[model samples]
Target chain A: MGRRKVTHQLISDNATRRVTFRKRKDGLLKKIYELTVLCGLPACAIIYSEYKDGPELWPNLNEVRSILNRLSELPVEKQTKYMMDQKDLMNKMIQDAEKKLEKEKMHTRAMKLGLMAGSNDLITDTDCSEELARAADVVDKKLKAIRERIKAVEAGAPIIKRD
Target chain B: MQSSNVTDCTMRKRGTKRKIEIEKRMTKQQRSVACSKRRPTLFSKAADLCLLSGANIAVFVTSPDENSDVVYSFSGYSHASEIVDCYLNNKSPPKTTINPESAKFWWEEPDLYRDCDDLSELRIIEDRLMRTKKHLMDYLEKKEKSHSVSKSDQNPNNDSGSSSSSSQIASDFGQNPSTLSPSSLKIVSFDQNSYSSLEPSSQVTTCFDQNPVFSVGSESSSDQSRYLVNEDSGFVDGLLCETEEENNGMRLPQETQTQPMFTEEDQSFWENLDVDDVFGLFKDDNNLEVPLQDHSSTNEDDELLIDISEYLSEEAMECPCFS
Candidate 1:
């Protein structure tokens, strides 16, 4: 029988959750063991549950201690060189997204200039050109209003401002 | 074809299998069996991930049995304790010395050092090219000045005196005027100070007199004929060979003797030189604003010469990174 796709969510029933946890725990331990063997790098995981009296150790207690000792021996700078937590990962992702947005904005500006110069080949997306045209119309309207205000001031007339 | 047929058979078998809900409540026996079977498959997946990405991972899981006190732990090649410790340490705030705002993962940092090294190497090559160009310009200027002086000296009364005198000298040397190519002529004793102090016409005459083989009245007509006979083979080669033989064991340095003297390659180097290419090297430098198309004014040429000299004398000598 083919296994049905399971939605990613917490199991609500206690019995079902326990069963699922047991299956997943075994699977996770096996995966970690395989990863250690294949990558030749030290990795360790600790899982806490209300059902367990003590956490299980992979390989054994002695190997885990030795690996921790090796990690501790490294200088703090070297240890932290590649280290990142949830917050750091999130911050990095946000920074990357912002940089991408800035690049896209610059590209859009260049495309708008190309459009104004009457080049159609620069139009990669119809929506982008439409948005740019709307923005251009808004800017043109603002410019006309500013020009009218300047002429009113030159003619020594009191101008009422409207938005 | 056989592999395709096997794949088709597997696909047919897969299609025939009934879908079972993985999330449905399972009996205790069924759950135990599923856990046992899935363990190896999960391990294989982890092994594949480790092999592909070189990631260090460790996972620990508690026993699901209410009576069981066992907590299982799994680690990659390294000890699980190390990864756990690293993870714990990473969970804490980083040191104050390290700016949190600028902190990036090792992979995120750009390889600026390699780019810097490339830029430095390019600067070295550009500097060398500029020095070579300056030397070539100085040589051509000296040659032009000497040629004009020689012409004026030869023809004080007539405009065609240089042509006539050259022909006379060529006849005296028993060679065609065209055969005495300017590129073949090597300056033996000329220096900047000597060139400035001595008259160009006198210096030109003295060059021939300085050589024993070419001393007009000193050598017999027959001896001159013998030297001229060898000259028919190659003017520069004959002169060098005769000089070496006459010097009686005096030999020039290997580099001096083997060094190429104004070959076609060198001629092409000058011909193919582009001012734009030289300027392009400094295009990214904000402090330097080289006028791309302006080379017509003598003042600009002088300024460029000064800039090249400054680069060669000051910057090149004191560039600590390259040194």
Candidate 2:
């Protein structure tokens, strides 16, 4: 009967997840309604659930569209500026990822080099040494590919969708 | 027997109250159900806030699945859009950052920029077309009004119906098929600038060649000119003025002046669009007009009555066919 606090993560169990979503969604809507009523502010909410046929909008669809239409009237330069800011953040993330990947690659390379120099301390089983080397090669290739993708995204290039 | 078994079943209850972890992946159905249930509660809260404080607030949410959005407004006697317009009007140079809470939910998220691009493109075209029509109506109305003082002088039926329909068709045709060409983009760009400066109007002929879609390098340029026409003709100003008068014992002439200038028909058209169909907004322009009598006057709400009469008179003034 005790109510224990849980983390705000997605629930994994099917039944629990469904129940949690329902309870939390209701709580959120209640908060929104209270904010409007107590503050007398003009507020709207659009909730789209995957299971629903269409999005569940608060108040009405017409009102939301009208607000969106007004928001969209913002000058093109302003919107473009917002996009540019996003691009900048993306580029920064890519750079950080690249640095992390470089450090990892060097560490892996050193281990392979040490193994080749007959440093048996790093490898427990002598029989699978070749396999270990091959696995490291595959990892290196995957990292390289990921870096390339990061570059492409930074350049505003269209990403090729993988089927 | 059930009480004795409680110790053995501790695991069942413990599992239900397990500690929360980091963001975990959720099933599509779970996510959907969560959104659906939470959405209504938010609106009810908004409604309550409006009634208690007499403050205007708008909440907008865009669903990830259907790419649809919902808005809740505590506008009281005023339409939601008018409240937003007043907000925007009061803050002309909107900050570079929009709503902080909603920013993450914006359709233009970096990964989803393509969809956002198409939508803004459509909005630009729609905004341009609205302004053009407004100007055309203005010119035609002025000419008609000057030529004859009496409403009986003009051809009411054919002109009102045809002009609106023809303009809609003309804009639709002009944008879609020839969107690739640069010449059309150039004309629209020119009009966009001139429109901002309050030039009398753009040449209607320039509209025939203008396109909404842009080529790669021109995104920044097009984005700069994407100033949407303010849909509010100052209805909020009038209402706000009324509010201020009750509180301050003095009248605000400036705000009152702007509302009546828009003419009743234009106000009705705008309001109806906000109140009516979403998908039908762009397509069905003609049939949406409800009879004037349909409006509520039961509470003897003088303000509502005045608004209705303004619309009726504007409709009469525009169409000679109507008695």
Candidate 3:
């Protein structure tokens, strides 16, 4: 059976959270092992939890110290070459999303102008086609309202407002 | 009949959907089993990342046992100390080590063909090969055009129109040998008082109205009475002999002689050339591997090579009849 989509939130129950943590912690350690072995690079992780007596160290304390020492020996510029903190990662993600949004907005504006000019050429894109369908629905509603108004005037009865 | 009934029951169980309560707490034994089973898969993925991107990584995880203080640690290197120390000293949060512009995550890199499936990997390789071939072809064509221009320039008797056209072609390639223009060719008298500023080894001075051509003597002579011609094979021979004599009678360097005078074989080679031949040349020369290893470094090297090639082509333009 296929798994359901996981909710991105912490488990409220203490027992369940502890269980999840153990499982995830093991998975994280395994990943670190694979990375170090496959890439032949220095890497170390330290994890702390209430369940454990002390913070867990991958590959032992000696290896972690060696990796850290090597990294510390490098110049500050070299050390930071590919480094990004949580804030930096978030900023980068935000910037990329904003750029994409701006591009999408421009595309939508162009599509709207094309529709207004009564040209179907811009309908080539799926997004443009969807937008066209929406515009057509609005136009249909407006036409129906106008038709109702005209009928009311011809019948000389009270005209109900429709939007 | 009993065996058939048992088989039917098994089939019914297999066909039933089992909804997992993802948020519910699992039993202690189930949790342990899950951790054990998932750990190997996680490690395998990390290994793949390390192998593909050459990135250093370290991970530490605390054990779930309530009384245990043991923290599991894994490192990409022999010891995780190097990475840990770097992190501690730098006080920077961990981020991806690969170029961010190329890929936010190492796994996202398209160039890591190892991660791609067979068809896509093949397509990437083919695309790279095609681009390399195109670049090689362009370089060869440029070299040929420059060679032809240099050849035309060697004939001093050629009309101004031909010289100008050759110059135009040379200019198109951004390599105009301005000093060696045919229109600027003139034989000026070698006056010791005026030419005394020239190098002591430059015994023969050939001057045009604009540019001066200085020729070193065959021997240590103070004589400035030798007349330098501005026309034909004689001038070329004098220049070559003067240059060769300076190098202890060694022929011009192989690099300067790269653009050989057009021959029937060369013409045929150009005619028969195709993508396969270019690809073969790349393979034979081992030029294809450099770009694959480090694209940025290779790009810088390629630019430098282009500059050197242009300089050499200009030198060739100045003395086309070296052979």
Candidate 4:
């Protein structure tokens, strides 16, 4: 096992605070310095602590007030929804299509196996109870496709079945 | 005395006005207008700082919806990727070995094969599958019976099929009935030993008049000989229409055929049919496809506190009913 040695570096809080204030102040000024420098305006900023005096006072206080105002103003809430029905409908259609695709495959296999050709034309040609037979044909065609597909796939490899 | 009283009233009014202004300054709502004014100044100052100091600052503000936040970043100036890199470099964890039962065994590069514990699932599946398949076969047969009679009923001339099957049916001697499995090579015999609950006749009868069938044109020639020839003059036209329908089906790819909207289909079906006859035929018969009505309504905040079992049980249990 390899253990690495640790090193400690310390700076006094008062010193760090002084350094931080100086750095942040410089940074803030550096932010505004561009505009002030370009405009060549003699602008000075003075920040007075609330803890120091009975009455609070700041010089070039408008800038500090503006910064504070900007920070405080931000929007929070946004939009959300469930849309359960549309989601369910989409899922159902997907399932329906999958089932149909499988049946068509199976029917084709059965046909190849010298079985009956379960073509939808069976209903149309018959001049049957038109709508009822048509609907049945739709279901039959869907089932046949699914079965043929299942058989072909199962013969070759793994077959995934939907519950 | 009158002059002194006037001076006192004027001073009191001025004091009240100053108090109101001070109160406005204390409230955040009152400060909102000032805040609006300050935001532009802040943006300008930030842009100026970037241009002046040559610090590559990137400030982004996102819509409140997302975790994508306002990022005021600098590549070298502020920490971004460097902190994560430091954290990662500090300690390297070894990969842990997976348990044999875990799904990871299937995903790893090396093949670690194990027999599935639930071999019983196969038998259960096989049983269900056989039942379902039997149902399907029965449905198809029922559909075929209904299909033949339905056509003959609609257009009586259609009875003169292209083959001798009809004559054989009318003869009433069950000497050579239709093959149990239309496909002769491989037949899945219904085993009477295991489950006698599933009857072929029961399954076949269910499909009658409920679901009709359609055919593809290429398959027409193969089955035309199966139909019995007719003595009537109208029989020839019926066979021709069958061929034409088969051709129509052949023209469109299965999925691409755009199903007409209900209003459109309803109109067309009514327009083509002898309304009295169509209604007469289906008056007592149950339909194959019972359309399920859409329950969704355009309602806002129609929230109901339903029990989990009533609404979401199908999905939580992974049951097929919901699907």
Scored by lDDT, the top model is 3
Q: Residues A1-163, candidate 3: write the lDDT tens digits.
A: 9997744333445576566666666666655554444333344665434454444566777876765555555566655543433234346557978999999987877668666557655446565565667667877999999998888899898766799
Q: Candidates' interface RMSDs, in order?
A: 14.4, 17.8, 14.5, 18.7
For each candidate in the order shown, give its overall lDDT on alpha carbons: 0.48, 0.45, 0.49, 0.37
- Compose the digit string of candidate 4's lDDT tens values, residues A1-163: 9976522111124454355444544565553343233332222222221122221112244643442233234332211111112233346457878999989966764454332234535434443344445456777999999999988997896777799
- Candidate 1 root-mean-square deviation in Å: 32.7
lDDT of 1 by residue, B1-323 (tens): 99999778777886587544335234655544554454445444443332222234455333334443333334434444555654555442111122234556433445524466677776875687678789889999999999999987986765354466555545655679777654434324332333344432221222223434322333333334112112121232223222323222222121111112344555565455568765445345553333333335454233323334444766677788656
The TM-score of predicted model 1 comes to: 0.24
The docking category that best describes candidate 1 is: incorrect
Q: List DockQ, one per candidate, in order.
A: 0.04, 0.04, 0.04, 0.01
Better of 1 and 3 by lDDT: 3
Arranged by lDDT, best first: 3, 1, 2, 4
Q: Residue A44, candidate 4: how far off, in angstroms? A: 47
TM-score of each: 0.24, 0.19, 0.25, 0.15
- lDDT for model 2 comes to 0.45
Best by TM-score: 3
- For model 2, residues B1-323, the per-residue Cα lDDT tens digits are 88768656765686476533323225656545545455445544443333322223345543424333322222222343454454445432121232333446433455443455688776875687678789889999999988775554555554455444434433533433223222222112223323333322212212212544323332434332221111222222211101222212211122110112234675575675644464445555457564343433344333323444455777576786754
**Which tens-of-lDDT digit does each residue in A1-163 have in candidate 2?**
9998754333445476456545555665666554444333334654433334344566676766665674466565542332212224346457878999999977876676666547544356565565568766876899999999999999998988998
User: What is the per-residue lDDT of model 3 for residues B1-323, given as tens digits with 9 covering 90 to 100?
Assistant: 99999778777887688543333134655544544454445444333333333334455433334443333334442234455555555443233344323444433456657666899777877787678789889999999999989988897554655545545433533455454443423233344334554432332324343444433333223232323233331232222112222222211121111112344555565565576775346445443322322224444233323343554665686785743
lDDT of 1 by residue, A1-163 (tens): 9997754333445576577666666666665554344333344554434355444456777766665555456566644543443234346557978999999988887767667557644346565666668667877999999999899899998967799
